[model samples]
Target chain A: MAGELDVGYVAQLARMHLTADETELFQKQLGDVLHYAEKLNEVNVEGVEPAAHGLPIFNVFREDKAKDWFTPAQALSNAPRQANNLFIVTKVVE
Target chain B: MTKRELPALSIVEVQDMLRRREVSPVEVLESLEERINTVDDKIGAYLTRDLTAAVTEAKKTDVALPLGGIPIALKDLINVEGQQCTCGSKILGGYRAPYTANAIEKLRAHGAIPFGRMNMDEFAMGSSTENSSAQLTHNPWDLSRVPGGSSGGSAAAVAADIAFGALGTDTGGSIRQPAALSGVVGFKPSYGRVSRFGLVAFASSLDQIGPLTKTVHDSALLMNAIAGHDSRDSTSLDAPVPDYAKNLGRDLKDIRIRLPKEYMIDGVDSAVKTAVTAAVKQLESLGAEIVEVSLPHTEYAVSVYYILATAEASANLARFDGVRYGHRADNITNLFDHYARTREEGFGAEVKRRIILGTYVLSSGYYDAYYLRAQKVRELIRRDFAHAFEKVDALASPTAPTPAFKLGEKTADPLQMYLADIFTIAANLAGICGISLPCGFADSESGKKLPIGLQLLGKALDEARIFQIAHAYEQSTDWHKARPKTIAEGMKRAGKAGEL
Candidate 1:
């Protein structure tokens, strides 16, 4: 029931690249893990509702009041590089 | 005090000395630094040491606050201003936090000295610290084996006596599992009991910050120091923080302890089962009654946890574009290229794998099948715990199936790594509170001994009762007095033979 999930497919999905060996290794491991998870399919769920958060669901809202805010300079002070009230980095748009 | 000698001091003893002025904060800091220098090489506990700043901070604290003058190691995820908050990742290798975590700021206001950062699984994703991009932290008990993690460094550091106590974060058993593995006391206060303002999110809904120490009393002391609501954290509960230390030594004469049948399944290591059963017998001797209970849906906990935790992680990690303070790739031409190349270069394989699985679960078409279904199952798991608690005062179980395994033993298989947290994750999934303490030692067939832990689980805001039972159990057992042979004998060999 196992098949080769190519390195390019994983890389494309993960948004990264890996060497051939790393790809082969991860492919085998991830596939094995998912197959194990599929073992859960053997269980029967009749009408059980999934529990998310512990407390009863409630809408937590604060009054819409404006408060003091950090200055652009202060907020951007720890940026590796910054200019003109913005964090500067490598060119992104081709 | 030698490296081994310091690990045995109770937090209260350290605080009392600071109050008496018999030992200056600088002296305590220096002693811990000496221990770290001598002990950490064997344990690999500390990730960053801010000695100059710590000494400066200690010098400033001429007067002790409640927990002031006590040395504690901050988990790497917490942001301490001007110190690197690596979160045990290569991506944020040199990234120094611009501001301090709200919890750290509160600790400073009360005079607690920040010793350094501890290692963890990268972004707190893995249960074992093996996923740490930095290095493996060895169990103080046996150097070849692991200390439980993603907060493994903090747990090992405290276990080795490098510091009196240390702060660690838990999301799916990071704190308790490691504490159990290392033969120390680890407590996770009720979610929202402590602020999570600066902890790097692994699974936000599941994460809670707590303490690891040598005793239940010390764990409660640190909880009193750190537990309170903060306006900065929207999720922080607005309840009053109680004086948890007051009930530490209370008698648990008639407390009803529940033994969930689901937890005592086949496949639990015989050694761990024996230790936990023995711990229950000791509790019964103290007049506590043990009752068998059922949590029928226990088998679904791990599956539900992985789906929900990874889904959240996928969303939480989207900010690391390499443009924001983390590592960046060279010659990135497009936004997609920037995200892809930077993350490719920055993140470790485990981190990337989680992101991919997380992304898949939350993807447009599969969202309902995986993510939504997991959420509903999570609700059922919580209800299961709640249903059982109605009939008992608290619940008990072995914290993990086995003690700390050797490094690289489970790293190859992610499922095997995930299984390390099987027993502890249920509490996180249910959003209840739990604590782990040394039960006894498990005798290995090879004549090596490993520590086993017994977990005490309680309902929301009932930490006082949990502490009472844990303290009572500690009072009746000598298992906690046992430390690693290396640490205990290392001090004697080094000529610091005052106490063993």
Candidate 2:
């Protein structure tokens, strides 16, 4: 069951680097959790609709009018690296 | 009132005194400051305090307002302008909120002073505060045990009388479970009843902010202040908000309460069963009808919760990529490495495990098998509640299977810790409101009396009915008035020790 899923691939997808020990540990833990989750297979949910939310809410549109919003300074206040009121990130094309 | 009695005063008592000018807000703040200075070292309830600001705000408070001059502790997840909102994770180490949450804005408008920031499980992930990267909050009842989590600090603050009432967010029983363990009143309003704007999202679909207080009436008062529609939150319900405090002291006659047999199954502590069973009997004596009902999907609640909550969490937590806010990795060579390394270093073990699990479940091949199936099962769980409500007004169960376990007891096994919320998770899955309050005590092996909680679950948007039932039961019993022995002793010693 553990071999059915690649822990490293999932970690890569999650964008979380894992040590060798953590990878080994999570492989086993995730397998156990997945095994437990397999119990859902027994329940007859053949015709049941998947509920994304408890209450049904739809088309929650607001008027397309501009209003007060966070200033660039406030938005950039917590940025780890910022310059000229712009977020600094690793260059995508280098 | 004496200085020692100040900490024990409920919101109602404190509000009345403020209105009548019997006690100035400064005096109340001073008393609470002294109490927190003395007892908070032992409880670790607060992560940070803006005492100077709180004092300044108290002086300007309007005496006639609903919660005027009342200092309420805020769970760190809720934002307050210019204050640290760590959400119990090191990733947010230096992150200060630039604006206040909608709930905090409501609290401020009602004249409630948001004073101290409380501790919680990191990103609201674990069931114990031990997962908190900053500090460990101890149970006031027994220092050796946990003060439940992820709102552990919020519950501990109210239980130890450091705050009149505190705000806590419930995503998979975070608020109610801790309140149960800490022997305080915790209410999780129905989804959308309170605006989620500015709350640090854990699992967006399941998270709802609520109150933890010393009394059910205080919970209702807090709810009245926080519950309403907000255009800022698209999901916020447009339903008319009721004055929750108005329904209190009402008789519970003709209200049908259901006791689900599935909750009383094996693995529940005998003492917990005994206490909740006795509470049901007390409710029966209070003129409420008690009927045995079954939510057949109860056994699948925890499983379904983990899948849906973590799946949503994985998506919700993706914004913490180290550039916009939170900790950033140094010496990063690339963008992908930056994200991976920052998250790896920022999140704790339990958080990482959930993220990994979430990522896997939502992955392409496994989506239908795990995530989709869980959502469909979630609908079944919701339907079970709907069918039950057709016959009964509310459901009752033990909030947790047992009293507070010794710290570090379940930390090693994530699965075991997940089971601690067995009875409470169903309420979240069904998106109903639930409240946990003191019902009785279970004597530990050392003869120490640890508190047990009786949970009353209500249908979606029907908090008024549950409040009436909970208030009636609470008034009939003296459990809510029972304080932790250790806290009581600490207060006495503080009285002798003089003001800080």
Every model's TM-score = 0.94, 0.97
* Residue B429 alpha-carbon offset, candidate 2, angstroms: 1.1
Model 1 docking grade? acceptable
Docking category for candidate 2?
Answer: high
Please provide, for model 2 over B1-500, each residue's C-alpha lDDT reduced to its tens digit, 9 standing for 90 to 100: 47767877889888887888889999899999998998999999999998899999999998788889999999999999999999999999999999989999999899999999999999999888899999899998888899999999999999888999999999999999999999999999999999999999999888999999988999998999999999989889999998898889888888999899999999999999999999999999999988868899999999999999999888888888898999999999998999999999998888888888898889988899889999999999999999999999989999999999999999878888999999999888888999999999988898777899999999999998889999999988878877788768634322233211
**lDDT (Cα, tens digit) per residue for candidate 2, span A1-94:** 3347688888899999999988888788777777777788889999899998876766588889999888999999999999999999987798
Candidate no. 1 TM-score: 0.94
* Model 1: residues with Cα > 4 Å off, grouped in runs: A1-14, A39-49, A90-94, B1-7, B62-64, B490-500
Lowest summed lDDT across 10 adjacent residues in model 2 chain B is found at B491-500
Model 1 per-residue lDDT tens digits across residues B1-500? 43334445778877776788767888888877877887789999998898898888888884558887887898899988788899999889788787778788877777788788999989987867888889989988888888988889999888787878889988899999999998889998777778888878888888899999988888988888788988777778888878887887778877999768777888788889898988888898888998878887688778878878888887788877776688878876676777788888888888887776677667667677777777777777788888888888789999988988887888878988888888888888887889999998876565667889999999877888898899999988777666677665545312223222
**lDDT of each prediction vs. the true structure?**
0.80, 0.90
Give the native contact fraction of candidate 1: 0.47
Q: Which regions of candidate 2 fall more than 4 Å away from where they truly are?
A: A1-3, B490-500
What is the TM-score (0 to 1) of candidate 2?
0.97
The TM-score of chain B in candidate 2 is 0.97
